[model samples]
Target: MDVTYPSSLALALFSITLVLALFVRSLRSKKTKGQLPPGPKGWPIIGNLFQMVMNRPTHEWFHRVMADMQTEIACFRFARVHVVVVTSSEIAREVLREKDEALANRAEAYSIDLISHGYHGISFSAYGEGWKLSKKVMVTKLMSPTTLNNTLVSRTMEADNIVTYIFNLCQSGSMKKPINVRDATLTYSHAVMMRMMFGQRHFDEPAEDGGLGPKEKEHMDAIYRALDCLFGFSVADYLPFLRGWNIEGEEEEVRGAVDIINKCNDPMIRERMHLWREKGGKEKEEDWLDIVITLKDDQGMPLLTFEEIRAFCKDVNVATIDNTMNNVEWTIAEMLNHPDILKKALDELDTIVGKDRLVQESDLCKLNYIKACSRETFRLHPPNAFLPPHGAREDTTLAGYFIPKGSQILVSRPGLGRNRKMWSEPDAYKPERHLDDYSRDSMGVSMLEPDMRFVIFSTGRRGCPGTKIGATMIIMLLARLLQGFDWSLPPGASQVELVANNSNLFMAKPLLASAKPRLAPGLYPKIQV
Candidate 1:
């Protein structure tokens, strides 16, 4: 019994509403046109995706373009995505501090889902109560100063083992055989982390042939494959329509690697749980694994399920081992390339930590020069060239630019570290620049502060919680290595290549060097706990 309207009338009304909506949108766009940061004009639809990918690598290209345009902040478009790259310390501070609340969470990524176990870990979890709880547990149980102090014995012992292992190699032929610096550091880092986290060592003994056994290699390779997925840009990441196709097969590869890692790690976790339950949960906590399995929340419920525990532990393993190893290697490489600097570091080490005993954790605070060297290395080669992608949680403004909801934010660590305005002789490696004031700030030592001038550990709410432990690890290892051995490029290797590989985030080329013992022969004995 209703009155019928013609189809044409309904169509006319719909067309009028669409026209009005478009009119309002154009007006809003016009108001903000001049406010956006200067950037290259992109083609319609695809935007600058093709142009950026066709040019130099994404990080380098952005640096070059920002330099050419003389802009601290630049805006660009990639398909439907809006990207904002900040290259100045001032703007970085604004984004990371002033607008930190709106930009703390990471942009959506498939890898976060696959690798972080549905964003359960601290690094990739969404910014909310859950992330807060998880982070609280990590800070209190694992990264607290008291806990680090308790583990000092284990770390120092590991450092001693490394020196002993190197000495063992030298007994056969000395500097005649070049040692793989990367392999040595990686082994040391992994072993120490295993002991601290699980209360056990991964490797029982050196293989009969004195190389990593098959099982050991399998476990290490699985971790490497899983972490490698974090680097570079992927088409599936930017475009949602192509995710199902798995065009590059990244998803499948990640899944396989995760399976392998879980296979290797699950049994150890199960054993720990079994022991805890057998004791009616009365066992005193000794390590990170014990803490995660035993800690409870406000409601008297366990803070994490078994799966969540595994995922969080895995995050700690990947971040702690990978970053510490890479940072140490880069610092050494810098020293090798600059012999004068190497001599300076050695002078500092020799003066501060003598050959009477190995460098201990207590010695790190007094070694300011060594700390400077680590800072310079970070400025030059931050483990992550680009900080993890930050997104605008709501419509906001950054440096007078109109950043709509869902705009991606990229803070270029290498770019800002090398910025000419912020530093004098930014391209050159000079540790003395950080020596102006020897006082400690938020990051412990002068060199380790969380200033926007050099964001090695980033800043604000999402800053790396492991900074304190990480700084201690790098300084301690570097001090010990330089104190115990003199390093140089192997024969026929004219120079150490500093060029990075595009395949991964870390140094592309392996660091191979000849090591000659610099300590007294009598000091080479194994350290007794």
Candidate 2:
């Protein structure tokens, strides 16, 4: 029953329909098996694999499947793997929180292994000492409050640059400029993380430096290349033993990208190790690179190899930068586009900081409204609408239902955050709900204080370690920007929707936006907050 519509989208849909038809025929022919959780039927050999891979927003498709099947939880099997999509908060907690030890492991694909430099990173690595040591080093050293405070000058300078850059762009009369918030946010995140981790940066180069050194360019380029290949569809991943069929030139592309990334980190890792060796057995620098380079086990032996060190450098480059940058940019976009929310943020900042200083981590606590705003933005535009697959490592019954080992379990933030049953007025943008001003009780705002049901940064042990740093940057950047300039969406582009362009279940990339800044100079440069 394929309809001959004369459109590319329709033609593509026909391919989907043909795939569905083949799936249905196979399902009917093989009705002897026990009931599998509900899902869209697909072709015989591939099952629904093609359709699932083709659809960019797989979360939405999962929701549709759930609705059509009227099931709270459904399992979609791909090859020998079973991917269980949990729709309700109770079940999500059951898997991600209660019996978390078994389910906290990541589902590692072969391609991920290839791109992650043999899965050395914490994000996709198997649950082991490597993950433990890497996470510990990052959480304790690189992202601690002390490091954040010590590096306040650098963060403030970047915040200052953001303000000055916006001011200059406005001064150029480019009010209706296509200011790609993605790129802008990426720049800020890259600089902040790079400076904090390596004491080096690649932004706003001086004349003598000639606009960023070669190392900085190589660093950014390699990181981007690694990311590009990390998400690439390698045939080896699908059929690792058979090596299905590598796309033309894909091997070269993957190797080149991986080499670029490995080369970028080797020098830094080597330099940090050398610096440590010269300290004469005394305590070395407590920076991230220093910590990883010197981390020794109980026997006082270096836990990670030189290769793992480079891999970890790439890991920090991705996990810390990608979401934090997008989150900051999206927060700005949401605030500027929605006047009521912008007014609320401005009023809160003015009352506390009062145009006297820029917002800082110190102000993060006292500014309840600002915190609520950050939480609400995370709720609505969760940098990653879904966390990476947390594998079911053991055959266990979750929520009193049996889940087999090797099943790929998915926890969807979109379904949970937007669920009407869970949130009152789930569609509105209100931060007051999270504030304890029970005095403002009649505003119909749903408070987000101490709740994991929304699962923006996820829950339990495997949750994102950089949540505080990431969210704090968004609050500070947004507060600082609002301090300097009033923003409005550009003419004709004012109403653009804040839609998700997710790179995968684990990454939330925002849509491009155009806007105008209308603020006076010297207003946002104050950064004592």
Clashes of 2: 3
> How close to the true structure is residue 463 of candidate 1, measured as C-alpha lDDT?
72
* Cα lDDT listed for each candidate: 0.74, 0.63
The C-alpha RMSD in Å for every predicted model, in order, reads: 9.0, 6.3
Candidate 1: list runs displaced more than 4 Å.
1-34, 52-56, 203-213, 278-282, 439-445, 527-529
TM-scores, all models, native as reference:
0.88, 0.80
In angstroms, the error of model 2 at 120 is 1.8
- Location of the lowest summed lDDT over 10 successive residues in candidate 2: 1-10
lDDT (Cα, tens digit) per residue for candidate 1, span 434-528: 77656554343554555688766767777788887877777777787788887988999777888665544467877888988888888876633
Report clash pairs, candidate 1. Answer: none
* CA RMSD (A), model 2: 6.3
The most accurate candidate by lDDT is 1
